[model samples]
Target: MHGVRIETDRLILRPTAADDFDAWAECMADPEVNRFLGGPQPRAVAWRNFMTMAGCWSLQGFGMFSVIERSTGRWVGRLGPWHPEGWPGDEIGWGLMRDTWGKGYASEGAAATMDWAFDTLGWTQVIHSINPENHASIGVARKLGSTLLGPGKLPAPFEDDVVDLWGQTREQWFARRRR
Candidate 1:
């Protein structure tokens, strides 16, 4: 398999697998976790979404990673670079299982994903689409050194929803790292 794996000091960001279903379903099924991510979805819906992500890797060469805690060896969430057709931009996004909140995993995974996107994937820029009410994600974006770029909207199913595009260029990211 040509799956990609990125290791951080505390977590591993890798491609999704069939074995990841239960944990993925668990997280996706949580109302709190999905509050700003389009609301809680049924297991069947979660299965289709999970399969879509897996297919994205096979077709796009890059997509959301199944975030794993190094210590627990359990799935914590999914965070990484994504650029599906009709997306506002190349984005590095995240959604953790409610239990995984407040541990800084989002920032850790996002930083790694930004590094991989800018350096490995040769992407020059990355954005994060944050709902105005999603203060947590806004904080994470700030911690990652991304500033609010402007307003943006997601494609169908979420076309009516609004988002603040937060991001930095590859150069900006490197400069922040040098600090």
Candidate 2:
């Protein structure tokens, strides 16, 4: 599981580093950014969350990557696949700083990761779980051609919300990509 870097038209998706603390923390601290995911977290908590995400790559063979802009090289957010505790299968997740919202970076980066999950990793299925009220993420799921797999939940490390699960199987992915 060597480090993987994915490039898009306007963004770079790469492994996160210690230097990303400030930017990542800022995003996690933004109320708008964290609203659907248990709200803004304290700095210390956010750092721990980032570290957990970083550690997942080593432990799980696949995990989210920090989303950076190509021109400014600024951290915009994170997008990739993860194996969340108790999830039935691989989960695809994405988050962007409040300031970077509405730019389609989430969808773009997520689509890239979906490609890798299916084409590179040979995964048969990938899930995207979000709170039902999170319209932004719902839109991203649609953009990536994922289908609603109905409701599901994983034990909360923070709160008690039942996350809505969306999914894309390898057959669906290949079908969508062909269009």
Candidate 3:
């Protein structure tokens, strides 16, 4: 949580922190924002879920980064390399606050994390486990140059849900970045 940090044109990406909790909880509480993210969670539940992300960093050394706005130092969202136990693949996912929607923050932050996952983490590929109905995420994946990899599976709680996997190989990522 202390060492790794990513800065994009308008955002900073780093591990989740205690100070980010209230904003994180607020984002999780937004029904519209959480609509595709397993629904709004109560503060107590969100706390547990939030700790899961932090735990990943402690144990796995890499997890979703708590996104911050560069200009305002505001907690905007979380997005980055994530592959929890029983996960579908090495995924780069995102979930932002409702107020931050339509601002290109998701794609902007995701692009930086994709680079970190591939170049630093040495991942061969990365995927975005997007809900079929989550058009906004579909658009972000498309914007990142990932193509549909067909329907995918999620573990336990999300196993029955419809998720479309979108991804690109590291080779493809570098090729696209060259242009």
Candidate 4:
């Protein structure tokens, strides 16, 4: 994978590395953390999912960044620009460990990712496919200045699942930044 790194005040966002698998697997195993992300998956399934993210980087040159805490150098979560085949649109998604829930890492990391998507990738717009029941994620989306764009569907196995599309255009994003 090509090197890509983003730094926030307390976080270091970079491409997924081999060393991040254990923590990533642990995060996927937690039911509460995975509740909106299709429930807790076994280690084997987690491995496949992890590889998928890594593959996205190799093939597309962009994928969720392995979010790490700068102070402790811990893998906190993954969040960044992602647009898999059959996805709704250019999306900036996030999933963090349950232990790190209330600290605002999702919003912090997502804010930076949004900037990267629009500025670096030159995306015209960015969307977040969020489960309606996932209030926490909805809150993060709002914090990032994205507005709800009604219901949307995912590809394949998730096609039957319901999600709301929330996002802002590049102009809106830059406008928000000026405020």
Candidate 5:
């Protein structure tokens, strides 16, 4: 398994731990955070989701990293790669507490994760699928230099709400890094 720890100017992206339950629950329960997630799930459901993420490292080799504020060493949210139930390929996903929004933490953490995915995992391309109406997440994709690939379907079991797929290839990432 990849025991990767990514660091940004103000955040440390590390593996999720048991102690993250409260923060994770808070973020997951926030209406703003779940606005595009089909509404806030209950605390119990959020805890289950956290466990699933913690287990993904063993099951998938790479999984979502909990975003922690370096200065406070507190969980801010989660950011990294994930493979949802029917996703065509590995996807990069991110979510931060509403209180932490608009501070560039999401972009910073995501950019760091993207660098790790390309340089360490050698992933040639990464996909980010977001609800069509989630403009905030769409902006994050653009900030990472990803291009909208138009409407796309995530495999079975997903709702009919079409998601916008954004992708960034290794070549594009390298070019951006060189800039």
Candidate 6:
């Protein structure tokens, strides 16, 4: 079954669907957007990666959501809570198309995502795996009230790429929200 959907003032986020392949693939192929995310992948590779996110929903009950701009009904990218097998920690991550950058969509989606993760998923903490050179994402993390927690490594395929783990506990997130 398909996972639940989340709506914000300007966006609609839902579980990845097969029909989203085109927009999803395009996002993966954009070098500007894909620079720090394993580089621009071919359409074929994007398909496999696409399935992984969709599969995570069926197999794990949660994963990235295909974000859509409500005004245009355009699939922007994927963003949400994700914690796969062998993950370093629970995380609410994001990757928006280059065109969607600077619009506060990531920050908006992240706030809603973190709320769901903490209130519904019952997660006590969240971590963001960010490459050192990825300054854009680092800004987003800071906007979300996350700070570097030291170095960490991802599981296979990304094992060699060390990342800075940035995050905060659910208590911390809520406490930040109150202010």
TM-scores of the candidates are: 0.98, 0.94, 0.98, 0.98, 0.94, 0.97
What C-alpha lDDT, on a 0 to 100 scale, does residue 27 get in candidate 4?
Answer: 94
C-alpha local distance difference test of each model: 0.93, 0.86, 0.93, 0.94, 0.86, 0.92
lDDT of 6 by residue, 1-179 (tens): 36588899999989998899999999999998988888899999999999999899999888899999999999999999899888899988899999889999998999899998899889999999999899889999999999999998899988988699999999999999999
Report the C-alpha displacement of residue 20, candidate 2, in angstroms. 0.7
- The clash count for each model shown is 0, 0, 0, 0, 0, 0
Q: Which residue window of length 10 is worst by lDDT in model 6?
A: 1-10
Mind giving the per-residue lDDT tens digits that candidate 4 earns over 1-179? 46778899999999999999999999999999988889999999999999999998998989999999999999988999999889999999999998899999999999998998888888999999999999999999999999999999899989988899999999999999999
Q: Which is the winner by lDDT between candidate 5 and candidate 6? A: 6
- What tens digits encode model 5's per-residue C-alpha lDDT throughout 1-179? 54678788899988888899999998899998988766797999998889899888778677889999999988999988888677766678899999899999988988898888888778889988888889999999999999988787877656575788898899998899899
- What's model 1's overall lDDT? 0.93
- The per-prediction CA RMSD against the true structure, in angstroms, equals 1.0, 1.4, 0.8, 0.8, 1.4, 1.1
Candidate 2 on 73-133: residue-level lDDT in tens?
9998988988877766788899898888888898889989888888777889999888888
> By the lDDT metric, which is better: model 1 or model 4?
4
Cα TM-score of candidate 2 = 0.94
What's model 4's lDDT at 139? 97
lDDT score for residue 56 of model 4? 88
Give Cα distance to truth, residue 22, candidate 4, Å.
0.2
Pick by TM-score: 3 or 5, better one:
3
Q: How many backbone clashes does candidate 5 have?
A: 0
- Residue lDDT tens for model 3, 58-133: 9988999999999999999999989988988999999999889999999999999999999888999999999999
Q: Write the residue-wise lDDT of candidate 1 on 16-67 in tens digits.
A: 9889999999999999999988899999999999999998889888889999
Candidate that beats the other on lDDT, 3 or 6, i.e. the better one: 3
